[model samples]
Target: MIERLISLWPARTGAAPIVPERSVAGRTLLLLITIMSFLSAVTLGGVVLMQKSAIAWSADVGREVTIQLRPVEGEVMDSNLRSAVSLAESTPGVASARALSIEESQKLLEPWLGSGLDLTAIEIPRLVVVQLSDPAEADIEGLQRNLGAVKGASLDTHAAWRQQLNTMAGTIVFSGLMVLVLIGAATVLAIIFATRGAMATNREIVDVLHYIGASNRFIAGEFQGRFLSIGLQGGLLGAVMALVFFALIGTAAGSMLPSEAGAQVGVLFGRFALGWSGLFGILAVVPVIAALTAITSRTTVRRFLSETS
Candidate 1:
């Protein structure tokens, strides 16, 4: 089977496969390659997840603002909330403004205070959700100042929080890219060492083949075919393992997350899938890794053969 695969590369059938069976050192090298490939795939998955999260965050940020109407001594909270909603609705750039009912606000507190507490006994701020036609056209400062007529009332656009989330996701992607680059460099170095070791171990076999008039291509082809198969096998195993891990993690996290926050976070990563593009990329890795291994093996053999002659 191995002989046939090697023969597919070079048409010349003169010399047999020179590289020995997978030894301890060769298996160890394959295992190390698999681990590195797995890490690289995981880094790629993180980049996708972070990118989706940032985009989801940006979309949420663009649509809405919140106004909090604080309860004051003897002042009517409901009336002030109505006045603020009216002002926001009438504003030129405002799309919609609706105040949350007291019951709805109590539900928001349920996660923190639990169901046992009577929310009515405590003084709380009224929240109004304002949707914008265009955030750029909205005079948010003017709206904030207008709301300030009611003591303790304040406007929060959430711009700072949105900007920070975007920056953080971007930073993660940049760091992941750097990690991927380092992995590629390590892969190259590993291949170089493996190729050198294989040649050194098979030195006597090579000289005997050369004495019998075997061509350089014949010897190099044997090694290249062997390494290429190893690389493809390792790359496939790593990619499959990575895809499964991310999918399982995504499912577990979604199950654990709070309903609302989970919905938002899930929208970004969409249940930890790589989709069509990611699958295609993973498929391409097999060929790419094989090619890299073949090239490295061929080059090492050719250079060493020349030096010996």
Candidate 2:
């Protein structure tokens, strides 16, 4: 089976590598590295997307404040809404304020309350959106105090929601980093074992090279270069697979998920779009994996040679 897989590879054009490139051990290591790289890329891309989405969520929430006007005895909602809007618009650091239409408000409730219900029969509170020029400059306390003067008016800065979002984002990003670290450690260990196996398989060749006064660096370099090639091939393939995987998910998300689910997904991942930064980060995995493979192989080879000598 190994020989058959080896035969699938294009024939070498010149002298063979010091470390046998077409062996079961090499193929296995390549597959392992490919799997590791794929997982790493996916994890990294997910983290980037989540982090960006979280930032967008926070920024959007921060830039807007909400005012809810509850009905009071003998108080007109329209007057209260106008009062709130005027107060919000005149407030320092506020950009604009607008009350949501009854229809729009009904739509917001449609997800919870079935459609076409008589909302007018119920004492539904009216909502006004206040846009902030800059959250840092916004006098939230003053706005809250001023809104307190309006009949049944209350201000919501969404501070609690934003805090929760930040906490969630931080946890997810930290988890992703931990996963990447674990994957790297696993890859390093795999490379070390593969290097040792390669050295053992080519023990006679190594002995001959040493007898000919080849330095440890030279022998290590040979193994390092060979493993580096394997790593590159595996990493590239894995990265491509990961890209395809994300692309498929992005395409499927719109058509496959239910409307509500899709909306939630959009809120979380923004149509599964990994911008240029994410693409670059994924591509960077290939070279990083290759470098790690080369370094691990070289170190393992040197250690083995020293022990034998």
Candidate 3:
């Protein structure tokens, strides 16, 4: 019965490999699975990275708050800055408080306005950064009121922005999961189509085998093995391709960004250097894909045989 598929490609496989080595349709199916796996892997990796970035962003935000001393003609800007820094430092739950120097503030603006900008011509508020021991334990409302008592002072922790970022990250992860589910479904359908087509192509041999007392499982096993091998090959190819894509993106970003900016970006997005665990996670896709392919093929073949008999 196995000899029937042996002639699937006379030029490629004479008898050694009987399943799907040389079948044009089989190769096309494999290619389709490979592309689908690639898309799935990329999205899966993106979700994983985004999750990590969200954690980092949350930690960074959760640890700090900023006190802005808006410029006012009636209030002494320097005195207000000093008073705000001292109040934050003396306050309970506050870890440290420091104001950015004029040069440092100018450096922050350099990215947008470039260097050599006039500092005295325009009024720029002093930025006093406040770190908390534990954001959860900190008395944020009390601290805000205390800071507001100082002239021209306002407090901002960027909670709104952080919440928005977290929402965006969750949306991306949910979207990625949906895409993976669709891809998996498409893969199963493709496997079913390929299995049924194989059965139809070798219907004569299969029918003969059935009459001679062959069980459905025995008939399905051959197709399962072939499809499993194809699935494994495609899965590995996809993982490798995804890794390469990420590595290239990392390299390009490193080259284009300044050292300080690159470091900041790494803190936000990770170094893009997925360690051994991440590699193992991606490589794990191989066995999973193979199992899905094998099961889908086996089930489809058995159903088809049962209906025909």
Candidate 4:
């Protein structure tokens, strides 16, 4: 076998690429990489959007506190509301306190209790919205203690809701990272299989090169270069497709803005906007994919050569 492969060695070196320029397997691998890249980009974009929206929501919720006055058998609702508002406004770090009218409170409950029903007979609690000059500076415990003295008045700092939001955001981010890691592992495995297949197809050529004193590093470099190009091509195409997908979704979200559904979507995604950092983050995947492909191919080739030797 050694003598046969030595005889088969070409007289001219570097006449053509060691790996075939194109093949069915190459195209299939390209398609796989493209799909992986697309999914990865979409996941990253979603994580960024959710993170920003969650932060904004937490900040908005933190800046305001609510005081609810429940109806007492003998106490006047209007008087209790006024006293609560006055107490809140007098507190340090309180920006402004406004008590919602009965009509306004009824509107808030309309979605849950249904419209056209008489809320007057329900004996619902009235709310006083208290905005803070700075959330960090506000003395929440003191205000809560003071509100405890008032009849049927309670202060809600929204601390529980904010903590839940933070937990949810963290969970989402961790899930996204796990997904990315899985995608990377899958890509590496695909490249390893592809590299071995390429080596098998060009077995005779590789043997000849080895017999003719060609180094393993030289052989590995050729495969690495080929796969790197494929990685870049696939990654760029996938990234572009992801961007287009986001654009279409954003346009649709914008059109839905006038409707009730649109308002809900706006609250969730905040216009589906990925800022400049997010865009750059998506673009950065191309080089990373390319590097991963090259490294995986080189390592695979070197391992195959060593095993055969």
lDDT of each: 0.80, 0.91, 0.82, 0.89
lDDT of 1 at 302: 83
Q: Mind giving the per-residue lDDT tens digits that candidate 4 earns over 1-38? A: 54455457666764545888888779988999999999
Candidate maximizing lDDT: 2
Clashing pairs in 2: none
lDDT of each residue in 1-309, candidate 2, tens digit only: 433443464645974557986999999999999999999999999999999999999999999999998889899899999999989988899999999998888889998998989888777888999999989998888888888779899888899999998998999999999999999999999999999999998898788677666789888988999999999999998899999999999888888999999888988898889999999999999999999999999999999999999
Q: At residue 125, what lDDT does model 1 achieve?
A: 86
lDDT tens readout by residue for model 3, 1-309: 544543332453443333547687788888887887778777777777778788678778878999988888888888898999998887778899999988877888989999998887778878999999988888888888888689789999889879987898889889988988999999999998988898888787677666656677887888788888899988888888888888887896688889998888787668776666566767777777889989999999999988988
- Could you give candidate 1's per-residue lDDT for residues 158-272 as a string of tens digits? 9898888889888988998899889878888898888888888889878866766677877888788888888888888888888888878888768988898788767767777
Candidates sorted on TM-score, descending? 4, 2, 3, 1
Stretches of model 3 off by over 4 angstroms after superposition: 1-21, 106-119, 255-268
- Score candidate 2 by TM-score against the native: 0.86
TM-score of each: 0.73, 0.86, 0.83, 0.92
Superposed model 1: Cα runs more than 4 Å off: 1-16, 20-28, 109-115, 119-121, 133-142, 148-151, 208-225, 244-269, 295-309
**Which 10 consecutive positions of candidate 1 have the poorest summed lDDT?**
2-11
Task: In model 2, state the lDDT of residue 135.
Answer: 91
Structure candidate 3, residue pairs in collision? none
Sorted by lDDT (best first), the order is 2, 4, 3, 1
